[model samples]
Target: MSRPQHFGWFLARGFGPHGWGHPYLDWNYRWTEPALYQESVRTLEQAGFDLLIIEDAPSLGSPATIDLRVRQAFGGPKHDPLLLAPYLFAATQHLGIVPTVNPAAYLPYTAARQFATLQHLSGHRLGLNVVTDTGSARHFGTAPPPDHDGAYDRAEEWLAGIKALWNSWPEGALIADPARGRYADGTLLGHVQHRGDYYGFDGPLNALPFTDGEPVIVSPGGSGRGLGFAGANSGVQLALAPLDRESISAYRAKIHAAAVEAGRAPDDIKILFAIQPVIVSSAEEADRVVAASRDPDDAAIAYIAEKQSSDLETDLTALDLDAPLDLSVFGGHVSQGSIARLVGKHDVTTTPLSTLLAAHARLGRISDRTGFVGTAGEFADLIEELGDWGNDGVLIWGDLHPVTVHRILDELVPILRRRGILRSDYVTGGLRANLQAF
Candidate 1:
């Protein structure tokens, strides 16, 4: 028997071109318009997904890497996902919409006011996927971005400042007694004055108080400081890790311990691991997909290189495939985690560039139970196993296009629902209620 778990969709490409490189581009749906995203989100809501998290990075990167960012539309040309949330909210009744927000980008007062308005407008279904990426700080003309721990420190201060504004209005601040001509109790509102190392704000936010709850806080960070931030602030922790029992258990234990240390219950945070499973029709097709990727052709290698280039912000297409990669080619601004992922268990001094790139293109079979390529039944089995290990849920990652959304959820949702691993109906309330329903 399997227990019910939450499910969500991650718009991995942010608010950029949805079906740009895929065959689905021929579907003729304009990615710039709102109709495409609205249709796709409705599909997710019908499939019983709890939320949709949009990923965003506001920078096109340094001048040297502009070509790498937009050459194949891998990373650049993204519109503000925050501006797109209202359209998503209007299209669905239950699915929560979480757009990526950086503390460095928006000031606490401005963010609080904008986010508060949306929370009430969405019937309390709004969520914030807070990120601490400081790479874009130059775009804002702020001081130089801080180090890893310092970035989190700024984020902690940023969140505290936002919350202070949110709580400025006390429970009895609004009376709304029309018969007595009394609208509110002026004395009940808090006068929040905050001056921190990174930010300072005075607030008694000019927004109505939330009756259901504030917007749900979502975060994605795997570092110790990141996990601590999640435990202290996030309602949902967007997780990434191997799917094995021990790895899953240890990851959750760290989050639980962090929550306990922060004076919060372990259940306060939901850890949903990110997975982009390749769904196929038959076991034979799954085998073919896996086999075809085992030895990537030149075209496949070029495709992988383009994506890695965008992420690393360093062009890798010109590098010699047969030669070992020079780690020095990566700039100081490049993410260490991205480098680790690219060089997975391979000695950078000995492994050829072709071998490193090929590792990423290889796909394994979920039927034989190695990786995420498989039929719907095999995919559900993996989900059920995660639930059995006390996992909260999984976030399906991909482009936010109707074709891509249907491709993954069409068969998988029914299987999950039948096994009681996915919710058939959401409880009344907002995103927080949905997460708590299980």
Candidate 2:
């Protein structure tokens, strides 16, 4: 049997909503209302996308300072994605709304009740993207951000505790028997006592259980331990699609084995990779887009430094990007799992700081490096090949401009349908059901 591929629209940077006061959007919704996201959500459902993951971060850059952060509006000037989930749910019949949340930042009970409420209200269309990061933890004076592996450890306990709270309300706990003058089976439920290494959560979660099962859990695994954690817990695991088929095959096998080791069936988890397909009418246009022109100078260097500071959770602006960096200052401070990825294991110690910055500057141009640049049909073929390589689905990141969105909806979606890769219509059940269908 052929399992069709799933697609999700990753709505980060407020795709169309934070229009920067631009009048050309052709969208009538004000920034404060659901009107902006409703159209995008509607378009996604029409094109048979599976879910919409609303990416969020508490800080756009280093939380310690304000000038560069506010100046560039890096990821600032944002409206909460959680604020939009309800509106999105009201606007569409399908498509899961999974918002990113760091478990450590919120009291486990609050997170549990919030998602459970959303699941019930959205008809089980809610999913939660669990993220373990340090930037946001600073704001609330929570425990210091754990090192990469340590963060995952906290996450394991955090998720377990949250699930326990969700499970506090047993199945059929609400009796609603008017004849007996009873509203619920008091003995059957209320409150959970979960004591874990990282958290002590006591419930009866104030919210009732979702009508469907617990809201879907999503984890993005960027490192080895992260993958292991995702394998053990996530219903859907996200990966940025690799540049080659070998890496794709290797990633799938690794994550699949991790799931099996965690006592789950190899097929139990759906692995979706992030892909941004640059659709164009012809090959020449693709070339022009790919041949991006940029000159890296002092200003570019400063921006890169700020970005690094933000990512590494430290300050790098004072250091010289054109010279070798001292390994001692940041030696143990850097999170092994994430930093190793940023700069290679060997280069972290040996390479000059300038070279590292240059590499990342080039990497930021990856959009020019990957994806098919031809007509929509050609891009569809590329998608099939990518799916054949391994991922169960792709998380598409594209501009929300009318031309780009329309080309995808009009030109690309049809080809995907004709090839039998995209679903013709949404399944009758909720987001999890449709996701697991393939």
Candidate 3:
């Protein structure tokens, strides 16, 4: 027997160029305009997706890496996803739109007000993918950014202040009795005063109270502090780990433990792993795709190098391909996990840079159970297996382009529905309700 699981799409490219550097570029959908995203999200809703998480990094790297970031449009040149959320809401009624938000960017009062407005406008279908990145501190003119744990401390304060403002208005505060010629009972609203180590705010938020609930809180962090934050505050955890039964179970246990420590039920938070599967049409085609990528040419390697360079903010294209990569070249700001991902099983001391680059460019076929390259049926089998493992759901990651959305969902959706692994209809309330339906 198979149980239904939640599904979502991750807009990995943020609000930057969609379908750029791909065959779909010829579609000319105009990334700056809303029509492209609106159409894409409509398709997602029709497929019964629970939400769409839009990724954003609000900074164009430091001066040294600006060109690398934008030269390939891998990073930066992004418009605010928060601004893009309203248009997405107008296009679809049920699919939750989660835009990335940083605590460092906005004051507590402003962020609470703005988020409250969106949650009401979307009819409680809005979500916030809260991020703790402090790299954009310079843009906000705040004091210097804090260290790892300190950043989480600031985010904790920020979230607490926002919640206090949201709850300032008591149950009887809104007394909209038209016959009595009364709009609201101002006396019932409480004055909330919050003065913390990182933020200070006094408010009974001007925004109206929610009819359903506050906006869904989504978070993506893998560190101990990050996991603790999710356990304490998040409704959805954007998880990342190897997609195996043992690994998945262990990861989930950790989250459940953290939730217990925080005095929250584990069911309060849904752990949705991020997966990008290459959905092909047939097994033969999958085999051919895998075969083609076994040995990448110079062009393929160069493309991989450019993407890695943008992510690390350290130029890799100029490095000698034949020489061993020096780990010390990476700055303290660079993520050690990212560096580990860039240099997989092979060692940096002995392996040449080209070998490492070529390894990343390689792909494996799903028929052999090696990688994610497979037909719709094969992908469905993977999803069903995840459900059996007591997984909450999986988020299919890709650009928010019409072609990309259709390419993956067209065949995969039907197979999933047939197996009773995907929902065919959504519940009435909103994102929170739909997620809790099963």
Candidate 4:
């Protein structure tokens, strides 16, 4: 039997309307109340998912208009995950709540205190997904945005400062000895006298020291700089790549080697691929659903093109959808995140117009690309086959809809458990221990 695999929910909007319209309107999900998000987290806990990543960005995505972003709901206007995380942690005993934090957007002292307080309160069931916001120059309220490698350079310093602040409260600092009237050992307090290239800070975080450890650190490492950052800091690395076994295996090997270079054990960091699973009642249903999603028609292409423009930073709305494109127009200007991924498949420098538009439509419209489309039995078989790479686990894009989410908990997970690839129940520990258990 294969080892038990781990799972996480990769949510862009807290609880989303991933498709254009409200498919889960019957589920009574109003963005105003915490009830909907709470219910989703509870469902994940029931299915024994290791963590839930609250994916966020400071600004909304492209077409350079609010109408498009709002219409699509593609990574826009999310309730602050940090604010929502505490409520989730309170509700679930085992599920890890990881909120995306942009280091540049926050002061180190402020972030250190924020996460430490949550970690202490949640019994260390907290994890933080760190992102380097490369969308625009003004994301950090700076004159010009940091370039690709520059963003990571700042992240390195930012995280170092945060760790220093977290370390300020030394081990065993909370000595509540009533008999001796000693509240804490001041002598053991750690300090953060950090002055670096990107940020500077002094003094220690005052929050109660995290007794167990800092919350799990999560990072999406698809770029070279990102891989280095994840290797050095991320407890769990988020990966998105071409859906091929060989590519996935080579990617894991690179990350593992990065960790070794950083003076850490290869297994210390787990890589969880961003996957969208299509689990239906039977193989036939799966085929139809997948075909529609992968080979989207004109309407689907236009719908997705708006979102892709945001990622690629190239507006395709005015261009010919069915006609071939002039790729040279985007010679030097290209998007970095999801846009880069779609463009990678086509020859952006020389490809025709329609081909570029099609590629954009396919990736932009569809979120999860870890292609396992079938019933639970087939899904489990696919997972076991991929596990041969020794990649840690897969984070479900989950489609941000209740029906899809329910299928994962109800149908997909059961088969995984029966096949011995999913945990029947959680073992004892916080986020890190629970994650490393697999």
TM-score for each of the candidates:
0.98, 0.85, 0.97, 0.90
Error of 3 at 195 (Å): 1.4
Tens-place lDDT digits, model 2, residues 322-355: 5666755553434555465556434565677866
Q: How many pairs of residues collide in each model?
A: 0, 4, 0, 8
Ranking by lDDT: 1, 3, 4, 2
Candidate 1 Cα deviation (angstroms), residue 435? 0.6
RMSD of each: 1.1, 3.8, 1.3, 3.3
Give the runs in model 4 whose Cα sits over 4 Å from its true position. Answer: 14-20, 61-63, 136-140, 290-296, 322-337, 359-370
List the candidate numbers ranked by TM-score, top first: 1, 3, 4, 2
Give the per-residue lDDT digits (tens) of candidate 1, residues 45-128: 999999999999999988889899998898879999999999999998999999999998999999999999999989999999
- Where model 2 places Cα greater than 4 Å from the true spot, the runs are 1-3, 14-32, 60-65, 179-181, 292-321, 324-372, 398-404
The count of backbone overlaps in candidate 2 is 4
Residue runs of model 3 more than 4 Å from their true location after superposition: none
lDDT of 4 by residue, 1-438 (tens): 787778888985554344336555666566656666777788888888899998776666434654555655765656577887888888889999998888767888888888888998888999989888766345557556677788889888988888888888776788898998999888888756887887878977788866667899999857777888988998998888765678898888989988998999988998888877656677677666666666767777776677765445556677765565555545232535555565666666567555665554442212233456667666667677667667578888854455657876687777777777777687776888888886
CA lDDT, every prediction? 0.92, 0.71, 0.91, 0.74
Query: In model 2, what lDDT does residue 431 have?
Result: 82
Judged by lDDT relative to the true structure, which candidate is superior, 3 or 4? 3
* Clash pairs (backbone) in predicted model 1: none
